[model samples]
Target: MKAKQLYTKPAIVGLTLLSSLVLSACGQSVESDGNSNNLANIKTTTLASSNLKFSEHYLTRDVRDDVFYFVMPDRFDNGDSSNDNGSKTIPESAGGFDKTSNAHYHGGDIKGLTKRLDYLKGLGISAIWLTPILRNQAVQGDSSGYHGYWPLDFTEIDPHLGTNADLKEFIDAAHDKNMKVFFDIITNHTADVIKYQECHGDGKPLFSTSKQLCEYVSLADKAAGKGYTPFIPKGHENLKTPAWLNDPKYYHNQGDSTWQGENSIYGDFMGLDDVDTDNPEVVKGMTEIFNNIISEFKPDGFRIDTVKHVNMEFWQQFTPAIIEHAKTQGIPQFFVFGEVYSGDPQELSKFTTEGDIPSVLDFAFQYRTKDVFAYEKGTDNLNDLFSYDTLYNDHNSSADYLMNFVSNHDVGRLAYTLDQSLPEASEQEKIKRFLLSNSLMYFARGIPVLYYGDEQGFTGDGGDRGAREDMMPSLTPDYNDNNLYGTDKTTADDNFDVSHPIYKKLAEYAEVYHGHEVLRKGTQKVIEHNDEPGIFAFTRTLKDHPSYTVIYNSAKSAKKFIAANAANHKVVYGEVNQQKNEFELAPLSFVIIKTI
Candidate 1:
């Protein structure tokens, strides 16, 4: 595929010293002004520097139609080995970078991703969402922060991942391929640096050496000395950069969370120090940090981490602030979605309706899709989930914004789920279910987020770390040891073969989605067929675009179905037995029909 020329504006001349300083920090430079100390003229010069030319088309595009590919950079590919162990200056108390260990860095960096732009573009991805690249805690417990969640410094890039310039190059390369980049970020907590020394009471909020020994205590009670006090990591308390986070008072300092009510909301997550998001200063600090990132990198979107853990009011303030800030930088339709991690649509929709997050990960749809496709459960469960779309603020566009996925890094993979849910099924049956589920996800009413290794058929199970296997099997020694599906696969290669069944199917689906406007951005209505077991159908319609219908049959027997507008429609994709105005969908098959 030919690369698209990213839009660029002519560089502006004349810059104040203050603007030159700011530009220098961003690796940009301007004509120096004689009055080096003059701060008054800085605003004008900086504004000129901020006038970057992004693809106007990308900036204004509706993200609902995008096909997102989420990749954990460290596990994807190692384009640079020198940055693997990170800098010698940075301390790595834990065993340091080890590709053999799932917990350590595997050397995959931004350069690796930049080198694979063609692979992703050919796979039909419109946007790439990478795990956080911020400087993370080098070591925590038995594991290292290779996953990029345990941020040590929010303002700087992790050396293990790449430098700031490497990130810019990756973004530019993606845009050159007509793809956008959505950065994953955390706001709820930082790396676990502070711990509590003693446990005072069973349930009154006393810190214990045991990380998960904290009890529920109201913020008032904690202030009154009724709760556990956290012991700051003496020398490390101020290790976090950007300076303000160094303040001990900014943390809740509560013991690890039990994931229950007040504790879950206010306590530490897995001993990661929970920030006092409710504090006005912390909120202001977080907002400024993310705002600076936006103004500097100008990402097309953000995948907010741990949104539910923070107070709803924090989002009410933070979400709009980021969006408005992007608008000021000339990106008007900046997409931002949060990870709610709830299987209930009502619970997930609250992020959008109450929290003001534009959209959230559609865990509700993911669960139902798994049940229907993997377990051969009826489509009624999925229909039920879609029924709750009304709970979202914008019901008509709910599917457009919600990020839908079959599996992600935090959960068991689709293949693993299929195998565990149907151990009795043959290998062929398992593959069938996997393809069916992915087809439904791609064709369904939401932006499809393809987890990195799913196309290559990585089948790691048991959730969490298990699901986060490397894309290229060559990086890890025990790549084939934990095959959840019992496929006996050994030595995973970064399979970029276009002919691979799953990859081909995904590419085809992406083509159809991009070729047809209705499928990308349309109103969807489920086609009910109570008598038709193992068969599910839905129709997508948009103004002035061709209406399309998608049908999936999971049963072993071919199922015939009639469309009300069948006479005007033709099969644009997928193979099915079509007879005049009737269509017979083969068992475990999917087809898309478009109104001619």
Candidate 2:
């Protein structure tokens, strides 16, 4: 089946870009350079309090203002390799994509992640988002159920990952260290393997297939006259349903492929079958699974996977129930951010305006910023990105409580996205561009999610799956079977430096942001906007407090911009150099000025 036939119209993916047109569709306000960065330049004063009252749901949560560090359990570390079980390599997988197989398992689990909690805290990250943790089907010579997406049973944690008790303990420990946990949840589909009459638990072989079981008829497919098929062996299919639904021991075996279908028209997520969310049985099952997790682990929030693939009406109906359940369980302030995967703020507004999840990932900002910094376009591009405010600024609950991220598990890393065409430039020039881009994320509004291994400067240029590589111990090469890619940076003799200068600089700025409330919660203004290309400058002000003016010299050579209004500010946050009157920004440098 093709994506156009699956869940949503295939055009929905591109619809996000269309929605961007709704913002600043007519024209925008442009403040001039006079009293630029000036705290007093604001024509009207709207006051925001450090102690602003929030709906009970957001009261105990600080996620909206903190930096989120995302980790893939299997690729991160083997805290205790004893958890390593079965063959590391799975059968029928595409061979030698990358030795590390970040997508596959490598003995990472809750224990492994917890062992490094201190390391994350040291970097000023306040939240950690871990990938799925449920049990998946096991196959011989395969990575096994390593990545944890395949759900054998929503009720139990995969023994390979650890016990339910271990999961709860990980959350408790993270909270103790002041770190929030975002548990990944998948309600869209289940594993492909199903039951067989001949299969025996004792010595009988497990059935395995790359094809998966999906309801033959979905709304998207039915519209095109695709016929329906029963998922369970209503008569005989019920008997063929995986025995794991009957017994946990059979959950790992490779089951029959006869059950699978191609629900491609629905969404881009591959392999797993799309559920008929309209079915009350399906809704109830998913909701129960969600609430049970909330009650058991008490995750600070949830990162819902493939949200748009299902009906928004379903989300409008189901998400509220999930949030309400959390409150009922005495976890009133738990957060939820869905994955809509579009670059349109207007489209995302539909999700936020609904009374369910708090916010969706801010893909709009990610796309624009990519065009802005990486491409070195004009200052107008920056203005265009911020203009989305008309739709997102005033949400039902919090204002501007969206997730702002530059890179993640699903996209190419920022370093990978940076300009690699400058072969003649020195390493310092490369590092400068990297730090400048990261600085924007560190100081910008909303939650910032740092992809796993980004701080260590992991680089990859491939699409989604190719971007998710295992974190290397060091930046050196080592010849060993354990080092799959032969890109092992852990060896002592290899000088492949993993200490990314960009991450260190960003971490330092992140600390500064933590101490300043203004940057975290303030009214942002674009002091200067130009269409000439490159140069861009802006300011953000917190009522009754000093404002910050940021200037970026985007061209290949030094450029000049007058901070005429910037001089009036009381405190300037950035460096003051020799002949301070003329603040010189190196090519691609970003400077912050405090208005007296």
The lDDT leader among the candidates is 1
The best candidate in terms of TM-score? 1
User: Cα deviation in Å at residue 319, candidate 1?
Assistant: 0.4
Pick out the ten consecutive residues of candidate 2 with the lowest summed lDDT. 15-24
Query: Which regions in candidate 2 have their CA more than 4 angstroms from the true location?
Result: 1-59, 86-103, 139-145, 194-268, 393-399, 419-425, 472-500, 564-567, 570-573, 576-583
Per-candidate Cα RMSD to the true structure, in Å, reads: 15.3, 13.6
Candidate 1: residue 595 Cα off by (Å): 2.5
Q: What would the per-residue lDDT of candidate 1 be over residues 143-199, giving only the tens digit for each residue?
A: 788898888888778898888999998888887766899999999998876666564
Output the worst ten-in-a-row residue range by lDDT, candidate 1: 21-30
Q: Tell me the deviation in Å of residue 533 in model 2.
A: 5.1
